[model samples]
Target: MNETIGNIKSRRSIRAFKQEQIKDEELQLILEAGLYAPSAHNQQSWHFTVIQNKEILDDLNESSKEAGKIFNDKYIQQLSNNEKFHTFYHAPTAVIISGKKDSLMPFADCAAATQNMLVAAQSIGIGSCWIGLVSLVFNGEKAKKYQDKLGIPEGYQPYHAVALGYKKVKSTKAFARKENTVNYIR
Candidate 1:
């Protein structure tokens, strides 16, 4: 099998992360991968906010969860009740992916870039998870503080985030892929 395909097959969402931070080189590569992701008309309207400081990380975990409280999601409500829950799953580093306002297909561009970063992280033995809960917090007035804290560019809105760090426990199994979801016209 091709190396890239093998990597794609082996990658899984790692929820538990070690305390150690990812190496600078690995972080650079991951960010580069996101930058290289194809964009609509090559507008490249995405911004990457890397948070490695423990204090800010903790703030993000708390604020995002607090922002999550207004949603009707049971899981989110449960997370609010559990003091142990960290939105980033205790990852030592987080990269927030935001899209520029007025950009064509900003969400799509961000999604592709985010997937690229996830694959790149996996290729380098780092664990990663795409987080949507945090985006919820960033969607309304609750976002102002984080916007300033993360230094999100004035015209950009954070669409998603990825938590990155070494895995506390490597996933030993891959779930079976769902079947009958594809169609062929030829």
Candidate 2:
């Protein structure tokens, strides 16, 4: 198999990360990878906001938990109650992927960019995790204030966030694949 295939097969979701920040050059390459992801009409409607400041991240974490409390989801409520729960897992950097709310395929476009970032991160020995809980904070009516604080463009909305940093503990376990997933129609 080719190196790219090997990288794809070996990628895993990383939850633990070291305090050290990723190098600027490496971070740029990862961001570039995201920029290269296929988009509808090449609209490239995505806007990536990379946050390296620890204080801002801390605020986001706290506010996300606070927002979680308003949700009826048992999981969200439970997570909100846990003091240890952080949306970004304390990673050194976070990239928020946003797109125009009116776009026909904004979610899918942002998702592709996020996946590209993830694979690029893994290939470069960086750890990454896609954070979705922030949506809870953004989608709710009460979150408009927080959304403004995030500095997302007026017409755009964030679709995903990715935490990036060096791994504190490498994931060595292989994931088990479910069998018979495909239905061949030929």
Task: Tell me the whole-model lDDT of each prediction, alpha carbons only.
Answer: 0.90, 0.87
Which runs in model 1 stand beyond 4 Å of their true positions? none
- Cα displacement (angstroms), candidate 1, residue 65, comes to 1.0
Give lDDT tens digits, candidate 2, residues 32-84: 99999999988888989899999989988887788788787999889988999
Worst 10 residues of 2 by lDDT: 140-149
What tens-digit string does per-residue lDDT give for candidate 1 at 1-186? 998997788889999999988899999999999999998989998999999999888887888878777778988888866898899998999999999989998999999999999999999999999988889878767688778877999889999899999999886688888999999999
- Against the hidden reference, what TM-scores do the models get? 0.95, 0.93
Candidate number with greatest TM-score: 1
Clash-forming residue pairs, model 1 = none
Over the full model, what C-alpha lDDT does candidate 1 score relative to the true structure?
A: 0.90
- Output the TM-score of candidate 1: 0.95
